[model samples]
Target chain A: MTNVKVTPLTDLHRASGAKMVEFAGYLMPVSYGSILAEHRAVREQVGIFDVSHMGEFVIRGKGARRLVNDIITNDCSRLAEGALQYSVMCREDGTVVDDLLVYVVRDDQVLLVVNASNIEKDLEHVLTFDRNGADVENVSDECALLAVQGPRCRDVLTSCPLFDDVREQVERTAYYHGFSFTHGGSEILVSRTGYTGELGFEILVPSNLAVEFWEAITQAGRDYGLVPVGLGARDTLRFEASFCLFGHELNDDTSPLEVGLGWVVKLNKERFRGIETLRQEKKNGPKRALVGFELEGRNIARQGYTVLKDGVEIGKVTSGAFSPTMKKSLCMALIERSAKGTEGVYEIAIRGKTATARLTPLPFYRSRAK
Target chain B: MSFENMRFSKEHEWVQFEEGSNLVTTGITDYASGELGDIVYIEFPEVGQELKSMEPMGTIEAVKTVADIYAPLSGVVREVNTVLNDDPGIVNQSPYGEGWFVKIEMSDRSELDGLMEKHEYDRMVGKG
Candidate 1:
């Protein structure tokens, strides 16, 4: 509990009866009530989450695009101003440093949103390319983020009076795009992006105005069934969508190619970190492949649970949960690629006993997000 | 089933003994259920199985974590609440009523003497 950071919305979350927990050095809300209900709120209607704990770094200078392009796996040079690209930064050996969002703000400025836990490590990693002449600054503490997500997300946002000045821009923003607008003399950045498999917008406001913005959005969204969500439902929502969580699916030693995120690795582009290794991996295939599965019954295959084939261990579960939307126990595991076969049954060792599981497609739930 | 006649164990389980018989019903406390969040499944011990005082009897699986349930006293499992198999959330809703875990036919009724009464258990859990 000592040295744990609190976001500006901490008091508000406490007032709403949130169950707070320490995650990645921050005392954040895991849930306000039942995670199932909050999960349903996002899938069926709309929900808002205080995701301010995530790290935000701003890179600026004439060498900004080059420095960013030289570090991440994805091609950011093709991005138009105001566009966002999902990418991963890798070590020299093609293993992940972190997965992040690259926001192209201007020709000379870029914003990188990364996992909260890797702030210091990521900052250090980025500073390695300082000789490229780009100025790297960690702006995580100065920013507060809110993810307004669901099928009805746009409707609730448009109806909020606080966003009256920016309603038009918010409505016209395309998926994976963002725009900066002034609301009541305060700068706000709105992006049509989210980790949840739902139509959503992630709004960024100054930390000092976080409480004001949250209350305003909540007040306007009350009639639209907008519930205040927490990290618990955030994980479940992302898990159901088969999105890769950094610690779970994309650790430092895990290659992007092995985790089904190969699309972000543009080996054909100019040289970047791990280009040689990733190109070799792409040609010869990775040693391991990430896959999803469904347990036969109520049995849950928790993280680090061994995945076996005929009593021999082949892999381990990276993430598992009783899917609130699917009502079935689901898991994502990284196993030896040679052992993969969609038709075969695998056993997941849970608390000494094993549960039978069947291999399924990567994304267990398809999003209704346009 | 009244609180006055019930005794609690340190493991957050409550047990109520029948006045004239050795039959005792046991389940987790409200605080335990609340802390566990949403209980999705429960692995109950089989009927007729003997258990020693404070021995592991079963496990409760919630969304976030799993917890082991211990036998409050020496007994033989007589019955289990099958309703939990279909809707484990009942444990979160009514932890002491229909959500009862097992009915044990006690072998040593005097073991209950070491258990805490309602007030003491409440104080131990910070309610009192």
Candidate 2:
């Protein structure tokens, strides 16, 4: 096997006593101390995640907005300057290429932040958009992103002089909005969006300043109970929020509509690639839908585990874990629409044994009010 | 604490042989439980089942991943710690005592000669 790539903060993670593991070809921290502890830290107070592995691309030149709009599912023209929108790029067959967050930095400048695994494909897709007076460049290697997320995130950022001028700007910047600011003598972009379903901010800074900036925020937020979270908690937190993961909940063969993200698709707008297939799917309905469930027993259903009803295999688990907050095994699955209403006890084929499971609503764990 | 009489395997299993009854009480070592995280479920092998050394006897599901429990010696399953069905967390809290997975009637006591002692197992795991 090829060697896994290490981020700039690899030493920091090791110093913090994080349990490092290979994930998506990167040697990343899976947990700092304990998965449950890190998971709870994000739910109650604040947690920081090294998200430098995600890909970032810059689209410049005139007609950039039009070109980007024609490529993505979301209507890019609707985004005002300094706003960000979540959308999906798709194949002609309506399958998702990648779900991305597009930032409208200026009328002619757009930034696309995509999943780490889909960087190459998304870059190729953007290049296929006819240019139309636009120039797309992949800038993933030059930038490092960090996420400080939780209810107490705003309070933590208040102490940084780098964020002082943008404090009010960030405070008022509603969800999915971003603003450019100077941090530690470097230009930084702060976005009030996160995948954890909590109020937080994502900061993009120069790769060189990543370690210094991470240490500064972590030290400042210590009193507020900010822990250096790892990808393990990141997955659990996102799973609890009903967010989709790249290969598990979504893939090149799964469309946004099939996963309950049809709201981002603009079917009526000027024709874009994959419009015909998506329109047809919208009318016919997806064959399978992503649904959440809470297993009755402690048996943790995992990816590729078969879901059974009445002793017959009906579907498969995409992502599953024992939720720290609820203290129960929870999962999300892509099952046939007909299996929706079938109640009573279901089973998950774990190993060679059939363990009983139950289907509950999504967001198995809800954040408590402070 | 009397691990001198107990034999261990590289997989972190410990077997304590009862001299008189020729029975073995098996449990995972503290290192195994710590690495596996909180134990959420434990599937025990049925009584009267014969198990070969190094063969999988049952499965243990933790919060992060599922691991198979291997037999440390050739034996016939005599009893299982049924309390684990309701309180599987015992494996994380007290693995050596109440977290014991099964008791077996030793079929081939010579298998113990192939297993490592606590000190040897520790050295193999780089913890000695």
Candidate 3:
């Protein structure tokens, strides 16, 4: 068996009695106590997630902004300093390489955080740009990342004296925005961004200080209902929010336009790598549209299962699970727009038997706004 | 609990033989359910279907993974817990009571001899 690489916090996860599993080439915590408990903890209070496996790259030098703007589908020029924008890094065919967050730290420096599995490919793609204008460095190994997510996250984090002044700053920062702060005498970057559709922050710190930082936050947030969450609940939470995972919802073959992420793509901007093909796909409409569905029966639809209409196979489920929050089996399917009839009845082939399913609107569950 | 009266299988299934009717009620053990968290779906075999000992009879889909439910004795399925259609979480909540997967009419009474008792099954699972 191939050995999965452990994060710098693996020992801490094990000491906390986390159930470790291989996910995206990293041996990460799947749960600490229970999946449902962790799921609820993040929804109701605050949860700390060891997301250090995510890849981070630093792009610096003159003309760095131009190089970044040329590669990603989103218009980065509109982003002010100290802001973050969600965009899809795509190939020339308009197929997504990965959906990533771009942090424009300064005029000459930008930080791109990508999915763990696509790090090598993303770096390779970024390096293909003319090296004479910009320098790209993969700094994923040097940094550790943690997400303090939920409604109570701000209260839990602001207790740290180092973040006292910055807490006020983060309060004013809107969603998808972030700023830098000093914590424990260490300068760290805190972003008001997360995959779980809740008010949260993603903190980037040095790898050596990760365990100390994690313990400090967990201890301070204990009375406030903060729990250390694992990857299991993280997956379910993101699925409920209809966020795209790299291999499941978004892949090298799936375009942003096909998955209802067209808003992130900037076609009006002068020219990017995938602009022409994306423009054509947008005008003609994608052949297959990714849609959310709720199974009527108890059977859970899984990946690669055929989605049938009137007993004829029309499409296939890409990502599916039992939504812990909604108490319903939910799935995302890529189906031919023609076969997506207005009728609510659809069948999912599960173990050779067809189970009834219905096309629900995207986001099977929504959080109560704070 | 009468330990000698109940028989178990290596797959963590348990069966209690009814004295005169020659029928048996089968369910996965508590240990099995603890390992498979929050069963969301259960596909049970239809009534009247014959099953061989140690053979795959049904499938249980949990929140995280899927496991096969195996038959503990050679028998024909007499009844299934139809309530599982709406409340599959019963498997996680009570694996031995309302979560019983099936009732079977025994094809051979001697099949029980091949299975383990509670003590042996517990020993095999490292809990004895």
Candidate 4:
């Protein structure tokens, strides 16, 4: 077996009898009790996920915003301080390097969060593109993140005493914005942003204090039915939100345009990596567009399953599951833009058998705001 | 039938032959259900279908993964769990009781020789 890494909360997850799986080199929990229950906890009440495996980088110095904007496809120039912008970095070929969140710290500073597996490559890419030699520090090993998500997330967090002194600030942090608090003499950052469509917060803490925060918050949310969710529920929640997960809807071969992320690409701004190519793809439209589908019955089409039209290969499923919320076997497939004329129905090959699937919107479920 | 007399397959299925009879009832083992997580769907072989030894008989769909339920021995399916159609979570809740997937009539009495007893199956699954 490959020697896998473990996050700060690995021991705690093990103590909770979580099913651990190797994900991005870290031994992360796939589920604690049931993925379905964990999924419902996030949708109906609140749930927490130890997303410490994600990578973090701090960029500072003059022109940092401009330089960061020059690297990511999204427009960061108009981004206000204390706000986070959904962004992606692209290679020169217009294919995605990684989809990330750019926390605009200030005019001369920003923090970038990337997929855990792409830390080295993303760091190298940013450093290579740093013409001014702006300070870009990788803090992936030192940081831990917990995603507290759902409609009751606001209440759960506001009730937690971890940062009670800044309770008002925590409660008032606007969507996509964050506030810093003092925890054990170290700066802790919590942002009102998450992959789940629910009103949620992503708390970033020092690696040493991850467990403390986990315990404190889980205790505070006991009445709210907060549970320690694993990566399995995290995926289902994000999938229902139609969030683009790297290595699924995005990769080195897939452009933002193909994944319905054109909204994040600021083509009007000054030249950035892949600008010309992405602009060209935007004008002509991507060859394929990501779409969601449901198999006619109970069968599921997992990642890389073929999507066919008229007995011919058309596309492939990127991510799929028996969605807990939707109560159906649904999947997101990147089909040829021409597959639209297939009359809303396509076939998925599951275990060598052809199952009929019909096109649906990207998100199979949306949280009904209460 | 109690779980004490059950035989297990390497694929994580449990079979218990009725006392002094050809009929045997089968279901996924507890270890199988634990590994599969919450079961969302189960596809059962039709009643009266011939099931060859160690061959694909049906499928078990969990929230995260899907695996084919294989026959542990040569047999003919006499009954398939119809309750799984409306409430599949029973497979995870009661893998040895209400969750039994199929009842089969043994085609060859000696086919059970290849199966593992509880201790052996537990050892194979690394629990014993």
- Best DockQ goes to which candidate? 4
TM-score of chain B for predicted candidate 1:
0.97
Whole-model Cα lDDT of every candidate shown, in order? 0.92, 0.85, 0.86, 0.88
Q: Model 2, A99: alpha-carbon shift in Å?
A: 1.0
Alpha carbon lDDT of residue B84, candidate 1?
Answer: 98
Q: Write the per-residue lDDT of candidate 2 for residues B42-67, one digit (tens) a residue.
A: 87889999999899998888778889
CA error at residue B59 for candidate 3, angstroms? 2.5
Write model 2 residue lDDT over A1-370, tens digit each, in one string: 4877778888899988888888767788988867777778888899999988899998898888988899898898978998999888898999999989999988989999999888888888878778877888898888899999988888888876556676788667778888997766777888888878778889998888899889988987988999998888899888888888899999888988878888899999787779999999989988887888777767788999998878877789999987777777888988876777757567888777787877787666553311
Top lDDT model: 1
TM-score of each: 0.97, 0.90, 0.91, 0.97
Look at candidate 2 and give me any clashing residue pairs. Answer: none
In model 2, the runs with Cα more than 4 Å from the true position are A1-3, A343-345, A366-370, B17-25, B45-53, B74-111
What are the chain A TM-scores of the candidates, in order? Answer: 0.98, 0.95, 0.96, 0.97
State the lDDT at A97 in candidate 2: 90
Error of model 2, residue B87, in angstroms:
6.4
Ranking by DockQ: 4, 1, 3, 2
Ten-residue segment with the worst summed lDDT in candidate 4 chain A?
A361-370
DockQ values, each candidate: 0.63, 0.51, 0.55, 0.84
Listed per prediction, chain B TM-scores read 0.97, 0.96, 0.94, 0.95
